[model samples]
Target: MSTPQPQTHQQAAPAPNWQSAPGTSYTSPIPVTRTHLGHALTSEWTKIKSVRSTMWTLGVFLLLVVGIGLLVAAQTNDNDYADVPYTIPAFFGLILGQICLITLGVLVVSSEYGTGMIRTTFTASPQRHRVLTAKLLIFFVVAFVVSALAIGFVGLVTSGMHGGASDNEWGGTVLKGALYVSLLGVLALAVGSMLRHSAGAITAMLGLVLVPAILPAFLMMSESLRTVGDKMMDYNAPNALAKIFEIDSENGGGTSQLVLLIGVTAAAIAGAYVLLERRDV
Candidate 1:
């Protein structure tokens, strides 16, 4: 009351040092690491796993490959497998299942473009080649692994039910069939990157697989085109798969199909790289 308290003045806090020292550059608090292909792969893996469409497509693929395979196996007796591998049943299912993989491959890349997410992807990884490579590798590995698992499962199930467990060739046959199916997926992915529209790319790939398979029959009416028609029928997706399973009349092993698919995929990938680099995302 009586004594007047001395006034206290709080000195203002010195200005925060937001600026760097004269000779030093400010370092970010977060650590920075140099990016490489591994980083790109990790990113691609994350993207593929997070998408719902991937799950749905793979789900449908397994359903077709496994369900139809089991159905085929159930309908047959041991005699049906006398000359064929237990994996033969899987071939019938895969004929349709391959379409699922093809569709998924197209959606993988083209969907990004459709949703305007490619810009974000490109911004995150400026090396378009690296990005594409990551996508290709991830997609191929996934396709192959899933195909192998589904086909192998059916083979094992049929062997147990109908008796072909001792056959040594089934393992190699399953691997070869899975590889063929995966390559088809890779080709579809390459096509997707180029077309960048899900519907268009899907249509184009369906045509690539289905058209050649059909044209041969129509072409046979023309005497001049008969030779070409025969060749197309022999060298096509369904034929290749049939040969792999030893279910076709031609009995040609599927080497030519593998070689042909590899060449086409390489060309498409090369083209994808060029267009990705040159075009605006």
Candidate 2:
């Protein structure tokens, strides 16, 4: 007391929970795993199958393909199928039904862009190319399977209805036609990804499928351009499918059209990848 004892203060110790422990690691409650193409594929599959647009488009497609096919089969005499493959009737339905596929293809990616869902998609995945690849894989497989089934159904019905008139070699033609339609859907998907606009891409694809076949008729008025128009008609999508179905076509053959479509689809896919990488999400 006489010394007026020097004041001694005790500092508050930091809480154990707040202190960082050396060499200690923290693990989150949520499990972490690396993402891959499989995850992306599952996500895309869920998206495509769950959407209303997919159901509506595919429903109309099946209706057109199967209904018109049956109608065509009913009207034709069994003897008429001798000259043409029984699968030839599938062309009428497929050509019109193809519009549904093109719409769906554009919607697959473009709808995401339109709705701003692409931001969430890119944010979650971070790899644009992988996302696009998954989309392509999922879309192409679905398109191919659905088209094959519809075409196969029509082929079976046509063959059964016109049993005596069916050619033995119609199998290859039916398979080829289905493949061609699926490829067109893939092409539409690539176009959708590249353009990223639904209406614009749909219009472009419609023109791609229809213009070459229709423009030639108008070009006949021009003496010089008539040959060019004729060439366009020969190489059009309808003529390509007609060639596959063994229908009367001035087109060279399905092989050339298949090769051309493959090349163009490849180029478009490459372009989409490059553009996706360069552009901001």
Candidate 3:
């Protein structure tokens, strides 16, 4: 048996430096803040800007789009435009420039996977979906803004060269083109997330964009496949951009193309979420 000892009282917990939410108490002295989408956006923006890939890709994109656009504008006279929009010049440059944006989209997610940084990212965010959402949002915004500026600049130059009386539609057309390119990059990101390999995702995206335009020829050879071939030819990315600029007027506007791409991107993103939540880093 042991000798009895005097009882002691426990001290109360210290208050946090900041006030807690109503009816909730946090005992730790260190201040705590709730996480939200803004935090994730900031993190993603920081990561995207800090990398060299973003710089190189965006730089090349601007150079090709702007340079090619100006060159085309300089060579063409107002009569060459006829019923077409002045923004038509920008379309040629974007045909090649979009590759850079697509590549950047693939690098955004796949690079993290390649370097084992996704594990750290998931550990930090905890909610895998939030990180994915943040990446999509961030990439879309950057891609859209940069694309708009470059396209807008080219449009302005083209309009200045051929300042016809009826060239008032440039603003709306420029925004629409930018939207298409940005969504394309987001689709690339979705593909990157699903594949988790940069080259494969990029190649797959290239095929997705290019094959439809080319395969239509072979597809058209079959009378039964002709309808499908016609649709693909009409709705392919190049034609979509061309349609937006009024360069492909006989085929209707780009509204169908945008709607189709949005649907596809939504489906790809849904699949990416499923894979992200189920698969280990």
Candidate 4:
């Protein structure tokens, strides 16, 4: 007699493996995050600070600003210059300081190309417009901040030499100077992007800014040529910007000059963007 076999229950059929099943997937429940303009800005900011040129250029700006201010202050016993505000001797250096500022501005773009880092920049930020816009924004912000500090120092130091200017007046002037410097920086960025050559852009910028002043001098002999040159010189765009900082000047009476400067800057930026979009990088 076979002993009664213990009831052997077959184990329940093995559960199917959900992960390896034909129709099943192991998707993560979390959503993927994307980078934003702000991230690009931050990355650019880091790049700017890390570069040696950033420090050297900014230092040159500061030294030229302060050194010229001190020199003018020491030279002038009484403010005789009607071209600039009598209260601040710093305006004497404004023209030279602006040149330095423009060089720094152009380098911000040109340096990257020189180093071959521009390729990396484009790689990290495939969107060209956003990348250019970010560069412009960051450049403007840095220019504004640095110029503000430099102008503030100029005002304070000038105040010690001459009686302090009105708080309202100095505040307005300083704000204007900072923006003025920043606008030039923006202009340089655009030109640099378009030209893609630092030396060329810098030379062109100098020619643009200076030729208008010098051509009028020579053209004074001809009435029509003189008229055009005079208009351009009388335009005195830089002087107009200085007036914004100093509030009063003999040559700083035109309001349209600033509008013209701003318009030119905008056109350059737009032109650069368009060209950058159409051309191969």
**Best-fitting candidate, scored by lDDT:** 3
Model 2 scores a C-alpha lDDT of 0.87
Candidate 4 per-residue C-alpha lDDT over 75-193 given as tens digits, one digit per residue, 9 for 90 to 100: 76534433344425455556677777788779888888887888898888888888888889898888888877777787676666655333335565566666776787789889999
- Tens digit per residue, CA lDDT, model 3, 1-281: 99889899999999766866789975888888999999999999999999999999999999988999999989988788667777777898999999999999999999999999999999889999999999999999999999999999997878877877354467877898999999999999999999999999999999999999899999999999999999999999999998888887664578889899999999999999999999989
lDDT of 3: 0.91
Against the unseen true structure, what C-alpha lDDT does each candidate score? Answer: 0.90, 0.87, 0.91, 0.74
Evaluate residue 195 in candidate 3 and report its C-alpha lDDT on the 0 to 100 scale.
Answer: 100
Between prediction 2 and prediction 4, the one with superior TM-score is 2
* Residue range 146-228, candidate 1, lDDT tens digits: 99999999999999998753454678778889999999999999999999999999999999999999899899999999999
Those runs of model 2 whose alpha carbons end farther than 4 Å from true positions after fitting are 1-8, 14-29, 249-252
Candidate 2, clashing residue pairs? none
Please, what is the TM-score per model? 0.89, 0.90, 0.89, 0.82
Best by TM-score: 2
Per-residue error for 165 in candidate 2, Å, reads: 2.0
Model 3 deviation from the true structure expressed as Cα RMSD, one decimal place: 6.6
**Higher-TM-score candidate among 3 and 4?**
3
Worst ten in a row by lDDT for model 1: 164-173
